[model samples]
Target: MKILTIVPAHNEESTLDSCINGIRNQTIETDILVVCDNCTDNTEQLAKSLEVNTLKTINNVHKKSGALNQALDKYLLDYDLILVQDADTIIDNRLLENAVKEINKDTKLGAVCSKAGIKDIMSSK
Candidate 1:
């Protein structure tokens, strides 16, 4: 199954590389789409440097969700499934494999999500 992962980023220079690496290291083959939303930093450049499919968002008041929906509405409808990921989060390499396995086993599965143990969630809040 072809999985297309969309990463919504907004000035995520510090954590973007880690996130990208996490995706790249996934066990299953995946097409990654990184949406840079109103990024004033080097987020676009970083994604471009990696030579991954990248898109920039326009009219992004809703932030990450808006950027994500832009890709969802426009390009990337050929994949079997879509993974919504945050720019700063580093997901496990086994995430795609595990999620796909579970989803495939249960045909009625609408969505599969894993827990993100963000170390600074409290500090950010």
Candidate 2:
């Protein structure tokens, strides 16, 4: 099955690399689409450098949700499966495989989502 994972990003240059790496290391390879929205950083450059598909969002009024919607409306229907991943997220290696298994096991599965945990926390020293 052709799977497309959409990653909505805005000024997330620092975390983007990790996110991409995590995706790449997944057991089930997937096409990644990153929506770079109103980014002042080098997010687009980084994505392009990694050879990942990227779309620059012209409308940035509604935050990440708008960027996500822009991608979904224009390109969502082209794939058999879709995953909306955050820019700062680094998914576990088993996530894709596990999700696919669950989805395939049942015909009624419309979508599968995973829980996210904080990767880092900072405290004023």
Q: What Cα-based lDDT does every candidate model obtain?
A: 0.87, 0.89
TM-score of each: 0.89, 0.90
When summed lDDT is taken over every stretch of 10 residues in candidate 1, the lowest stretch is 116-125
Best of the candidates, TM-score: 2
Scored by lDDT, model 2 comes in at 0.89
Model 2, runs deviating above 4 Å: 119-125
For candidate 1, the TM-score is 0.89
Error of 1 at 113 (Å): 0.9
Name the weakest run of 10 consecutive residues (lDDT summed) in model 2.
116-125
Query: What does candidate 1 score in Cα RMSD to the true structure?
Result: 3.5
Flag clash pairs in model 2. none
lDDT of 2 at 104: 96
Model 2, total clashes: 0
Cα lDDT tens digits for candidate 1, 1-125: 88898999999888888888999999998888999999999999999998889999988899877898899998666888988888888788899999898888887888888976757633674
